[model samples]
Target: MVGIWGFIPHHRVLEEDTILQQQQEFEHSIHKSGSESDVVESIDENTEKNDKEILISKRISSDNEKEHENENNLEVEIQDFDVDYDYVPYKFGEKTYKIREIRDEANRPWWKVFDEFEYRNTKSEAKSYKWYKWFPEGTSSAEKKLLVKLDIFLAFYSFVGYWVKYVDSANLNNAYVSGMKENLGMKGNDLINTQTVFTVGQIVFEIPWIFLLPRIPITYGLTIAELFWAAFTIGTYRVKTVSALQAIRFFVGASEAAYFPCIHFLLGSWYLPHEVGRRGALFYIGQFLGVLTSGLLQSATFKNLSGNGGLEGWRWMFIVDGGISFGVALLAFICIPGTPAKCYSLFLTDDEIRLARRRMKKNGTDVNQSTKALFDLPTWKKAFSTWHVYFLGFINILGFNSNNTSSGSFVLWLKSLKKYDTVMINNLSTVPPALGILYVLIICVGADITRKRFLFVSLSFLLNFIGNTILAVWDVSYGAKWFAFCFGYWSWSQSSVFNPLISDFFRKDTDVRAVAWMAIYIIGLQSSAWIGRLIWPTTASPRFHVGFSTCAAFSIGFAVFIGIAYFFYKNDERRESLENGIYLYNSETGDIPQFVLDHPEFVEKNRYD
Candidate 1:
């Protein structure tokens, strides 16, 4: 019978070290048995060796085989790092091949064999082996650089796409103030209703898009979605009726739904958990820049092109913005790397892909498996069961209340500023958010470097409370003006760090449904509009104390909620029970299992673990 020694060279080195240690421990056994010489004598006689030469020859052959197997096994291990398997190896017909780790005999350790090569027959074994192979042979140092380049390229592509994203939305507000309703014979809060419809469409599709994103190939899907939204944006410029305008905006919102969530998921796939928030900020900054650029573009184009081609300057704004979106969409198709596994078409090679995959896997995340089902029973329970989900949703609702209003009413508010022209107001209005984006980047970078999130987010909300409070209380005599400007800066700054917190708690690519999350935020935010229209009343503008008071209330509520969550979550981390829905901590020792307190059923059965 063949000895069950290590088969592959690389495997042998690891096993060699293990076996050598085991041999040392068992050395006395070999000497005590007095059978070592007898076994050596048997092998020598069977192989026609002289009695005196038996011991040294056998020892040298065994060592040589072990060394050879070690090198071969190392190569296999490196290649299999990203490929999932449940097997070890065995010998057959002069070749070493992998086999499933499952045992043919009871009481044997399963997973000792590699799962890929598991099979009772040669055909099944061959089929299993196919999955481990990748295109582009052998890993090299050059492949590492290529993967790094791909990461950089993705960053730049995301930046450009993010810049294009909010331009269309910003143009909506710009056009609303620049005679869109009048020119199209629109009336009522039809614009609000249109935005509502657009948001509804977005909510309906966001989750679906995020679920389908990985299967669809982000490079293709995102590029097409961008182009589709661009077409609808330009379509907005062509429409002449309220119904038509509403229809166009609804389509634009629907097409844009999957984008933000998919981008978040994509970034997560490429980055580590701690690394994600800052990259998230980079993409977000592009969005802030887009909003800022829209204002600057509107200021520059509104007058000179007022009647160019018989279309108003606002129409040209839509047209130009759409053109940019289309251009960037095409660029992304060529540049973006979908995932490390299939990134070979770009600069990355097989070895680099493995390295990137290994680094991500070290964080306990399965980087490439289709996470579409993460919303399924157990996982969703794990996610939504946590208080983090509710608090995050509430925090976002607060953000939405501010954002939706700022998106819709800000231009109208700026119309009342008196000192700036329509063009100047548009241009100046974009600055606070642009500056705010800068603050967010700085804060996020610092947060990431420090490996902390709650403090930054809490401090950010506090600043927002102060800024919005100033906006509410000081409405006249440049006090409100300065307040508005400062509020905008602080408001934008908060956004950069706050957005990534959603991903922080969720902590997986599959948990990312940006469109769905946004939809949830919008749904919650709609209440703000409902309450705002009644309490503050549209007529209460310039000094809407009620609106300000409501925002302040929510802001304070968020601070308290976040503080409580941080405490519980931090405790949960210490106990390693964060995964099982235990939020509160032990009072006396601070070491009590939340499962025992909250989930008494689990304790009664004594199976909480």
Candidate 2:
């Protein structure tokens, strides 16, 4: 019992200020050692020459220079147990101390080189202590195995969900011309409005749900949302009026609002930075898989299910899709992890949880405190202060344009062409979107390995812009139009970077992190939904050239905007690192990486800072 209750000596909850002060002193020391630190900035002759300094805090110290630098280094080596002598506390509690690193001329603290456990112990200890040893809850072997399985499962589930959403949206177009008009008496843009309404639903509830998701069981909220969409999806089959269809679609949209944000939060909870992108791509794969599945399924069943048991093929599509959603939702509830502490049920051990906490803490995101309040002020200020949020919004509009004009309506456009048989059209349709999934994986993996994302995202948007341009100007070959369709799928690849970027923007503020993420989704999602309607009107059916052109322009415009924002934002990551007191070293150059995720203590620090 003593082992369970008292595992270690009194532990200090390392607050953000302590972290920030340590980082500041570290940076100051780096600045002071002009020559020694210069070694860190050494040129890599093989790589292209760019003036970007990746990290402000991390630097390479040559082994030869180590002895001399170590001697000359004015910073004291604060032992893990020596913080009481080095730092003066601003506040005092039995389990806490407002600690500061001893500063020198360069403001480098003696504690910079200390390991996190040592650093933490030097400053404060918990109110109680235990002489007994306590074994962690899970074994090392179990933790490793659990993480791999969870990673794969998360990737697969997310991918499937994305596929379902996109495939379902696209199928509406296929149904519209496959006798949906005659069966339902639907006319004009009412078809477009359904898609528009869905986007609005996504926009309206995304932020609130994201804010609320982490507070409760994630599986519970996600399952409820899925159920709503599933019910609406089935309800769509019964709609005989625009009002009826609109109402059902609106509810469906609301149901889906939580899916993206919720999944993102889920992914973040389980994976580290390098792991997030590829895992995210798994979700995008769902879009690709959904597209493939829809085409194949539609080709096989459209004719047979056309009049099966008093339901048209189109009606069957909704019923089947909705049913699948409901089933998947049920499965997800049983599988998804609620939080890191409890993930041991998924086979993780107590040590892995400790390591996970330490890893995230070292990565600069503190998950120790209540995540509910992370979005309060400093985080929102960080989120809203930058142009990245607005750029993300515009990019979302670009994504909406691509999804609406090409993805949602591609089948109808092909039907209007009268160029190929159902199988041929279905097969041809798969190419463009399949390329999109490919591009998303390639870009995400590249970003993960290289530790650079914004540049690749910009380049992808440019490629999409070029693809849309060809579709807009050249109409002679069906091949050129086909190329445009493929390019449109890549548009969502740009969306992949947005979430990761949001993670960076608020890496310091835990209180408002969830809400900040929700704000990001709301702005990008809602604005773009309306934009999709404005660009692709119902009247422009058969050929959505104008809409495609508008999409191209937004895609290009957003790319350009992101580029400019990148320039202006110009790697304040070191500043944030110092402000947060964590080192996320760039693996390639051995410098601190330019991107930072929020620490969990941003809210509490804000009031005092």
Candidate 3:
């Protein structure tokens, strides 16, 4: 007794009346037609047959009238109800979806909508474009819990691992300036040579380590590398010649080379593009803290432990830093899980593991592929052929070079001042990197909110250019020169942003992502080895005008490269959209056609801006 207007009680009573009226009309028509067929005896038999025929017609007419009334009611209801004009219904196969309409207001330039403050306050709208879609509205409570666990377990280790790596590497500089030079009879540029040899080791082992990354569990690999490097760091205390120290440093660099790229790759495997930026920044913050701690440790050890147990203060620094590294290595073995699909952490439940795998797959991760393919020639070709590889690689090189100027020149300048004691010099050196930590944290949070990687990177280069320009002049007041030197560390913020940006660019290709990350470190380290020594030579001392000027020019070049890379990224996006038949009226809202969503490879390319 339900009408098409949806279960109307009054319509059920009215329907019975309308059915009876239709039946009466049908009987009248039938009787009128049969009146001409009447004869005496024939009419008697025909009357009985006519009665049966009228009953049949009455039932048929009643059913027909009810069906017609239902159709009319449905039509009236549909026409009267309000529907959302902003959403268009699309049907594909057995499924239906409501696609938000693309509006004209969403077509504004990226720069216009690139404010972090505004993006934080604004809620995402249905018909508008979002700069980042990693954390869309309607994310379940389960997903929020998973992200928190990931930050606690996976992100925490990455932070500690990076911290230990930087502290170990920087110990050489601290040791050399403290007492290693006097103890080991090291001469001009010998310290630089040791660092250069270490960089060479990193370049040599880069490819081999990347190949090994996928074949072995990342946690095991990281732990083994950490243990070996820790041993080599302990060996540094026994070095009697520059060659001995150089040999130890080389192995240290080789073992540590895998740590950075593998950590970045692991982060990408677990987190979405939007989430990876902040995590990557946190990892770099570890490096800043390590640098800061090394300075303070060096200052304290020089004062308190300089002659304890017949060991030089520099030797004790090596022993203590190495011991801490070994302890962290043991902790990493316990805490770090490899990847979502392969995670063996005791902290996770079965349901959480399944949820993690499903979420990563939805985000376009291919967990089934072999990590060993990182060395395949075709995979290498695919990675190298991309324009992003060259442009981003060059940007990393410039960034590392700029960072080296801060590490080398600032300490040398402090040493040349001769006003502060060794302890003050070491303690004072921590200030710039401390400022760098703040800069990196703020910029990375903004980048995540605004989804503006290239913009922040450009700004980092500008800061470097300005800071270096002031240092190159070298004629300003002491306070002015000091401020300029400290400002240069702001360039380090680019480190936190670049890795996540590259990961986002190559998200669909795991092997390519691994190779690209390796290339970044290899090129950066190798370039820094040669370029760092030339820019901050022993002869230059307090004011390396030539080196600072060269770095300033490189900073401008880095900014230009970033612009070109962004242009190419947009071009690729547009070309892919056209080839895939994804028509877009504006930058914001658009129909995500079923065909594109069904294809696994096209999912990220279509959805990500």
Candidate 4:
């Protein structure tokens, strides 16, 4: 039912008859006015010259007249507005952002940030390129200020939320290595089993929540999820047995499940194409930062507070981490703008809200506020039947496995060497993630600036292949082992690219987006859960030949997936360039389109070709 991949559907397409009819009517009007001297450019030449900026309906109603009077007067201004491209109207959706005026913003600097931002997955382009690779580009002064506000308000909060999440999630491994294993008398595969239990809880809730996100205000859901995760995380501080640990982790995992798809759906709903990739990387960086923070906190807790609090240092890690989540939950409740259309963040005036929605609309993603749901069974059918869901979902399965979910292996490997103390081990585990942050900063921004997503995506996969290839040949030198672990983190940077890429592919519809992300987790997480328990059992230690080989093969699979995906991406791009203007994907059809309705004289089925 979807249009050709990468084909945006909003651009104007005028058939010759339609053009001739309009031209003839214009000529008659001119004759009646007796202005026979007026110059008339050929419609074909005019259309061909402004083809990229395909004309759109400019009809304005009474209510919108004041708002659009200036917008309608806009002309081609290449420096600020850049090149015009085809626009496709989003056919279905929920949520619309509103804006009241912010008179003070006329003078605000583009680089400075004030207080708030929230929303996700929509595309925004950066027409201007900056020499500085670390920063995002803005097409004009207004957009520059807007990007700054969004970075601070919506994007920053989402980043921190995911960052804090990793703190709680990554702790199980950190806790075990420090002292939990010996203290609790843990047995075989217990480490993997506890994680599996958490994964099980996550998969259990991920489905229903996909339906639930559409029905609920975003902040309300995220606040509850944060609180639930916090409470369960704190509960972990008191657990005494392995069974108790497993039980608490399941609740923690279930509550935490809401964050991923909901945040991503919002992300797609709000951002422009040029902006999402780096912002996604920022959201991802917060995660590694959290992991780094947790390891650092674990090291500090073990050394400074191990015996002072009458609780094990490992236990204290849970309590402090949980306390942080409580603070984040409060922030979410108070400030996280759910969607640009429904946002009421204390930081933004009504003006900024309208601005956010406008950005979305310009990018062809503005949707009517009542269009999606957790159980839109028809939309789900449309979503599942699309080629994107399966292709990207399979790639994510490889990514989920290759992403340093297999990370603590380095920690265990360091442990097996008995070369470092517990504190050093925690510290060492952070190095790869630290390096990962730098990798994403460089690679993602470069990809965003160059607008070559598949190019960088392919490069990351190549790095993943190289890293795992070295590790799989386990009979290597110590230097090789060290290099393999560090190199994998670079590939880990690919997760950021994957996030925006999926958002771009599924950006057209909320219902479809929710279903797509859900399917990915349902498949990806299951693969991760069983794969970790099987190939990466705790018994394998630093020399997990099976684990390394499995990871190596998955990296190769990820590379191959992107190669095939890029072809579709380009093919779709080619389709969008056609003058007939491809049909906006009719999701209701629920299969590869039975026909290309826009092509003249090339009808399908009983129609003449």
Show where candidate 2 strays beyond 4 Å.
Answer: 1-146, 341-345, 369-391, 402-407, 421-427, 579-609
Q: What is candidate 1's lDDT per residue for 1-609, written digit by digit as tens?
A: 112432211111123334343443234334445566554455456653455355455655676587455435433444333322433333435855343222112232354232211122122222332222321233344434544575477767777888887787777777766767678876656666676667766666665653465456677677788888889888788887888888888889888876776666667566664555567677778877887888888877797888999989889999999999889878777666676433413444444455566645533344543433423444445555656656667766665554323434455667776766777778766866667676777666655654456666666667677766666665456656555545544444555445555554454444443333443444554455455454444345445566666666666666677677666655545343222211223334555543345434322121111
Q: Model 4 misses residue 573 by how many Å?
A: 3.2
User: Residue by residue across 234-306, what tens digits does model 2's lDDT show?
Assistant: 7889988767877777777788887788777767666655557767777777877777777666665676687
Model 3 worst lDDT window (10 residues): 75-84
Predicted structure with the largest lDDT when compared to the true one:
3
Candidate 1 TM-score, true structure as reference: 0.67
In angstroms, the error of model 1 at 525 is: 6.9
Candidate 1 C-alpha RMSD relative to the actual structure: 17.6
Single out the weakest 10-residue window by summed lDDT for candidate 4: 114-123
What's model 3's overall lDDT? 0.69
TM-score of each: 0.67, 0.70, 0.75, 0.75
lDDT of 4 at 545: 78
The reply for model 4, stretches above 4 Å from the true place, is 1-138, 372-374, 404-407, 578-609
* Full-model lDDT for every candidate: 0.57, 0.59, 0.69, 0.67
lDDT of 4 by residue, 89-192 (tens): 22223622221110112233443221011011112222134545434454545556656776786678888898899999888889999999999999778988
Candidate scoring better on lDDT of 1 and 4? 4
- Kindly report which residue stretches of model 1 are placed more than 4 angstroms away from their true locations once superposed: 1-151, 186-188, 341-345, 371-378, 492-499, 508-542, 577-609
